[model samples]
Target: MKSVNQIAVAVAVVGISVSSGFVAAQTKAPAVKSSTATQAKSSTMLKATMADVLKASQASDWRSLNPENTLYLEMDKGRVVIELAPEFAPKNVANIKALVKEGYFDGLAMIRSHDNYVAQWGDASEKREFKTAAKKVEGEFTIKYQKDTEFTRLPDADGYAPQVGHANSFAAARDPKTQTTWLTHCYGAIGVARGNETDSGNGSSLYAVTGHAPRNLDRNITVVGRVMYGIELLSSLPRGTGALGFYEKAEERTPIKTVRLAADVPEAERSKLEVFRTNTTSFKALVEAQRNRGGDWYKFAANHIELCNVPIPVRVVK
Candidate 1:
């Protein structure tokens, strides 16, 4: 994990919501949108509801930030690409970045695996019940304000925060009442762990999402961002037989050779990856197309997409 230097900022935006039944019913639409590219026009007529219209409205109003701030984790199986949310958790992001460049995770192992929850990796301290050996460098866990943060907000209602949106390129929660905001624990999410205190665990020990929506972790821990690609690698790892998914033997643990930042890698060595821009006409149409409105196939269109489930299609161009 790498900590980005950027900071988090709260936005005055409403939650985003889409119904499931209607969207699920409307499955086959002809005129569709592109998942991975910018489509010129959508041929499908979205029988969009008033709410879908609003959420799509914010798509045009999306706030895209620098990809240089993106963090890339290198595992033996493959590189797990993660975009860090500095705006929501600056110190956490920074600490991760520093650790990555320093090769702190060069020889660590993933010891914990909780099904439908998180897959964690760090100093696999066996015979030790909860040790903080990874905390060589202590950092502030949370922040009050972040300047120049480009927060792309969701219009759907969230069960977690006053508002929900994308910060540091992941689904997020914001609360004006407390002047606070943080990352939401959605699938493919990456988070920092703390023991008892709010800032207990530094960026040294971290975890990634593997299963369904784990909203319980929201606001309780620091969720950085969602996995942009190669989630199959992390989510598919074998489950541990012991409690908390702790491997019973040293051989059972997954070794982590190193973690990296995309900025640090050479262009040739770096993964030639392109993430579909969030605020695109094609994406909006794709979302609408996926919902299946104005079609016979779909009995009803959900007219909604989850922050975690939102298909952020990634591809390597030929």
Candidate 2:
């Protein structure tokens, strides 16, 4: 019998054809010319560090998350906040919201905690019925690329996709030839787990990536949303002993208190939070700052950064 991890890896092998133009655009290095004018310009510009950029940011640089699109996952340890990306997976998000509203995940427990992979939770016994939610949802691995979508393009080249950027506060990738855009498998990303069929998994069985960015999973699964806070609660869980990191016994699972939509929670009990706007100039400056690290602590500044390495800052409103 094949292990669950092997099956997942096998399912992720979807063929993607990269256009020649796309490859040429990303691989070509910029022409470097040593000129007196360039030297003078470089000397005059004072580069601001990421901290300095944040400190100087205006209120417009940040936006409050919509209550309707937010989720509060409560456990014995604490609450984990998640922001749903309805723009990316509308049907899946709606299904997930329905499942959440019907108290489908209240009694469920964390069944799998894979080392350097993901932490998954759901009805491990497969006994729970989908009262109001769909048993299967069409996989939304990628959506038709909309021209009006908010995509702040990252200059860095990625091996997985032709173009990588931030879309609606989520790390994303696109292929112009295919005219498709998909959310990436960055840390804290929430994905629906399935068996063999692409549409087999619904929102009932959800997992959060807690380790390295599994870019291989991109365009292979439906990424519903991402955890905005309390990722440590999932990452800190004991690694499962069984194959594919599933708990061998029911007693080993951690119980879930409830998973409620932020809008459903009372105003007094809600967590007011804000995330840095990626479409703003301040975000560009922040990215530039990170691309070239400042301060004397670093001996060498890695002038490049991976798409998943970019930090999406979030803050609690006091």
Candidate 3:
């Protein structure tokens, strides 16, 4: 009979032989055609790039600006188009519409152009008049959230609000617990300038954010709308020398030839522009494309996007 050590060595050899036989069988096995077919399917259905998503967008994916809610700021260089957010700031919008109809901002100059901050335009004269409306409308900083309100939420972490999203076409923030929603101060955001008093801003003086998003002003000030086009017309203006970017010399100010509501203008004279609707399947795809950056140029995907960083595409209807 074999000794205990000899028997153990024989058992080990047998185990090694069995393992080698199993490995050989696996190596000789035929590959599955299903894997290659799956790969081909995946390649065919690869994620779309931002450009591809936009190219695939349909006519219904875009929305036309309501003429009643659009404002055309005519200057020497060109027209600065703005889209008002009546859903967010109804009181301010009402006041602004009245002012625009009354020609309150027709000759008023763009008084301030604080670099990387805001470009404000209104009557600089001490004795400015609001011939069409009241001097003080209740502050419409935030409105009660309505369940019926159409909101398209972004899937990104925000340092500012509990929830960040877009309502209508405006960047907005909401607090579900409190049922409150307000427009954020994003690039090209148009806000009413107010004094220390809360109700002071009656839509007379307006400012457009030309730089980084100042989200701190979201619930503190009333945001009327956003610049839909010709942002460079305001952003590229010379920085004011005086404090708070007030032009020291009157001649330095850019004159506002006229600020008219698109509804008041002739159909032929109005700007033919369309904005991508936020609440659409194409928009969701567009947002995903932006978040991932599926193009070959990007070495790595970001996977996340900020609310303000998302581009709300606006194109002149061709």
RMSD of 2: 11.5
Write candidate 2's Cα lDDT for 197-290 as tens digits: 9999898999999888888999999998888777778888999999999999999999999999999999999876677788989989878876
Better of 1 and 3 by TM-score: 3
TM-score of each candidate structure, all chains considered together: 0.70, 0.85, 0.85
Candidate achieving the largest TM-score: 2
Ranked by lDDT, the better of candidates 1 and 3 is: 3
Error of 2 at 237 (Å): 0.6
Candidate 3 residue lDDT tens string, 1-318: 234333222222112110112234444545344654444343323478655765678989888999999999999999999999998889889999999999888888999999879999998884777787889887888889879888899999799999998888788889998899989988889999999888999989999998888888888999988888778789889999999999999999999999999999999999887777889888888778767655333444567888887767766664
lDDT of all the models against the reference? 0.59, 0.81, 0.80
Runs with alpha carbons beyond 4 Å of true place in candidate 1: 1-68, 126-149, 279-297
Sorted on TM-score, best first, the list reads 2, 3, 1
Model with the higher lDDT, candidate 1 or 2: 2
Model 3 spans with C-alpha error above 4 angstroms: 1-46
**Lowest lDDT 10-mer window, candidate 3?**
11-20
After aligning candidate 2 to the native by TM-score, how far in Å is the CA of 235 from where it should be?
0.7
